[model samples]
Target: MAVTLRPEIAALPPYRQGRAADAAAFKLSSNENPRPTHPAILAAIAESHLNRYPEGAATALRTRLAERAGVSIDEVHVGAGSSSILYQLVQAAAGPGDEVVYAWRSFEAYPLMVTVAGATSVQVPNLPGGHHDLDAMAAAITDRTRVVVVCTPNNPTSTSVTAAQFSAFMAKVPATVLVILDEAYYEFDVDPQRVDGLTEIANYPNLVVLRTFSKAFGLAGLRVGWVVGASYILDAARSAAIPLAVTEPAQRSALTALDIETELLAGVDELIERRARVFAGLTAAGWTVPEPHGNFVWFAAGDQTSAVAEVLEEDGIIGRVFAGEGIRISIGEEGSVDPLLGSAARVVQTLPKAGENARLG
Candidate 1:
């Protein structure tokens, strides 16, 4: 007989990573930084001693981040990735019968993490234009709600919540509920009006901000991320984290990445420019894309998702597809721009409804 598993766990599908591309294709499926890894980070990684376990606490990195964010050392916690911290936070705050609320189609990992922690997921539907309806999310919270996640420049959709919207939402939320602001793509957002989690974290005692080195720092392979919040809440997350999951190489690399951040952020500026071009190109092609604040664009193809994905793949552009939902194409190398736009234009012409559904309500 098969080993018995919790029915919910048994029924859940394993997480699917972005499709790998062949030599000719641009891998825009995972919103990775297209730039080459910086020499400094590589040198730092090379210096790691494999025989020793990583410093379990990642104290040095935490200290640096705390100083940078103007928080106490205990206020910051590091994990394998922001995703890992997310799972830890979920497990720390919620359990069976409790609810973890977030906007639908925000981060694919949110529901999975909630389920793994035995908590119910409360997904608030996004408003038209792929943005979170913060008011609705606030209203969804009940006495059973333990945590609420807000993903800015939300993954896949590439839309953001403004400062005013967030401030208003926070006002409506109860002080007892935990609010996690997932800002994994923070560096790519150029909007002056976008909510800056670090700047806002101090105001809310229950708020925690998550960020990662994966996107703008060109450190996706390193798998290091951090959070800034009240020491007690972060202490709970720490209690839930797997021991020594942050490797020495990852920690050292992140420290080096921080050292040369100015140089790294210059690359982020280029990606921002490329994002603008891709957004403009898609719009010109008659696909109504949400104004992208992340380093990617969303094609809300709805039922045409698979067909549009096929066309993109035929043109050597591999993007993440959510079957009937939509396709999320990351802004990649400069060379990918023309081919991506060409494929998008073809989809608009051949699949008229795809273009129509791409528009927000």
Candidate 2:
């Protein structure tokens, strides 16, 4: 009585996204903008006349994104979200026996999406400081490796690989191998040495940079994202996407978000301020919280992780509890920081100055 499912999907673990509990919980688990969308963005989405289908090619959004990104419309390809674009990229480029290489604890999407495309998932382990070991990842690339994903200011860990480090990694990669730079949280990351993929694209034709409206732009509900790559590859990724996937509301909302980007960036700056505050707060609280460049901080409590997550859940402050080491706490409004720090303090308050062994099983 066994139903036959595809080997790849059957073997793969389902992707777990961060979700908020009931309304009473402060949903810092998902790395999303805690603030609401700008008034302009809301107005545009509301003003969208939806009877007609969205632009098949998303020309307007593409043009606007091009202007913002300092590229031509041809250089920009708008997709549903970075997640949608990433999945489509796998559909377009990966296949059975092909290999997809990315850091182990980078974006969890890498392995799940790659396997969905019938490709082998090669997990290049992180470096000693929980950063991507570019040298090792580059060395993992074999003839079978078709794609490489780089998640800068990487999720959960908040570590980013440098431009110089990745440039060296890309140099070792075959010119035919495509490199996808995931910059979902770029706006909040203020690392001077961080790798901005826009600067690297001119150097590598195979380089593709993925950006999203979800995180910094506060349009996660609208599902707007885009990719910048060579015209052919961009076209191919577009071709692989679900046709007419970008809706009228999505296009207008994203453009509206751009209109108020000045204001939105102000919010980002606030988040940056809070990012520093939380990092310093956790450090002072006797927690081993990593200095994440993104909108969250990681509490790597080693053996004590499970107990912390349990305590957090009990306190109704949900965060991502990774395997026995890292727990992600998203940064929000200035008013929101104290409650989060309080929730964390409540847990750390009781521990016997010893790390807990915990995981999200």
Candidate 3:
């Protein structure tokens, strides 16, 4: 007989990753940085000692990050990825009979992680403009709620929450509940008005800000991420984490990436410029693209999502497709711009109801 598994986990679908593209196509499905790993990061990785296990606390990296973030070392927690830390936080704080609230279609992993921790997920639908309805989210929180996630420049949508909006939302939330701000694409955000968690973190006793080295630093393969929050709250996440899961190479790379942030950030500036061009191109072509603040753009293709994705694929422009909802195309290599624009134009011209369907306006 088959061994029994928890009913929730048994019934849940496994996580689906973005589709990989062939040689001739642009892999814009994962929102990965198109540039190669910086030379300094590679050199740092080469210097790692493989014979021994990594530092469980990632002390050196944490020290560097704490110094930069203006937080105490004890207040910082590093994990294999931001997603890993997210899981640790959920498992640490929520369980059966507890509810974890977040915006729907924000991060695909939110629901999965909550279920694995034996917590119920309460997903608030995104506003029509593809932004979070912070007021709605605040109202969704009940006494049963333990954790609430706020993903700025939310994944698959690329829309952000303003600092004022977040401040107002926070005012409505109880200090007893934990708020996790997942800023996976923080580096790409150029909005001066957006919430800077590092600057605002000091005000909240129950808030934890999650950031990743994956998108900006080109460390997706290494899987290093960190959190800044109350020491006690982070201690709980640490308790839930697997020991030494963060490898030596990852720590070294993150440290080196920090050291050479200026150089890496220059590449980010270029991606921002590319994003502007793509946004303008799609708008000119009569598609209503949201103002993307992340390293990707969203097309709210609705029922035409699959058809639009097919058009993009045929043009060798592969994007992350959410059938019946939308498509998210990452800002990829410089050469991908024209092909993506061309494909988007084709979708608008060929499909009826394209204007109404291409945006959740």
Candidate 4:
């Protein structure tokens, strides 16, 4: 007989990663920095001593991040990636009979993470234009709610939560409920009014802000990320984390990336400019995409998502497709712009515009 397993765990599907692209296609399915890795990071990785275990706590990296954020070393926690810290925090804060609240269509991993922790997910629907409806999310909280995640420039939609909106939402949350501000795309966001989690973290005892080297630093292969918050809360998350998960090479490369942050951020600025062009191109193509504040744009193709995605692939563009929902195209290499726009325009001309497949109003 098969070994007994938790019914909930058995029913859950494995996490889906962005599809790989062929030699001829541009892989915009994953929102990755399209820049080549800096020489400094490569040199740092070469210096790692593979024979020894990584500093279990990632002390040097945490110390540097603490100084940068103006927090104590104890307040900074390192993980394999921001997603790892997210799972750790959820496991630390919630369990069976508890609930984790977040906006629907924000991050694709939210429901999966919560369910894996044996917690129920309370997902509030997004606003008309793909932005988080903070008011509705705050109202969804209850006594059983142990954690709330706010993903600005939310994944798959690329819409952000404004500073004013977040402050108002926080006012309604009980001090006991933990709030995780996931800022994986912070460097690409140009909105002056967007919620700056590090700036606001000091104001809330229950808040934890997650940042990653994977995106802006072009360290997706290295997989280093961190969280800044109260020492006690982070301690709990640290306890839940897998030991030695943050490798020596990952930590060293992250430190080198920070050493040359200005140079790395210049690349981010270029992607931001490219994102603007993609948005304008999609609009001109008769697709009403939401105003993207991240390194990606959302095409609300609704039921026509698969067909539109196929058209994109035909034109050498590969993007994250949420079947029956929408398509998320990441800002990619400079040469990808023309093919992306051409594909989008052709889809608009060829497909039947109905339901959410038409212009968002």
Clash statistics: count for each candidate: 0, 7, 0, 0
RMSD of each: 0.8, 2.6, 0.9, 1.1
Q: lDDT per residue, candidate 4, 224-247, as tens digits?
A: 999999999999999999999999
lDDT of 3 by residue, 1-361 (tens): 9999888999999988889999999999998999998889889989999999998889999999899899999999999999999999999999999999999889899999999999999999998878998999999999999999999979989999889999999999999999999999988999999998998899888889999999988999999999999999999999999999999999999999998999999999999999999999999988887899999999998887888888889999989988788889999999999999998898888886656787444
Model 4: per-residue Cα lDDT at residue 181: 97
Candidate ranking (lDDT, best to worst): 1, 3, 4, 2
Ten contiguous residues with the weakest lDDT in model 1: 352-361
- Candidate 3 residue pairs in clash (backbone atoms < 3 Å): none
TM-score quality measure for candidate 2: 0.94
Ten consecutive residues with minimal summed lDDT in candidate 2?
A: 352-361
Alpha-carbon TM-score of each model against the true structure: 0.99, 0.94, 0.98, 0.98
Candidate 4, 274: how far from true, in Å? 0.7
Q: Is candidate 1 or candidate 2 better by lDDT?
A: 1
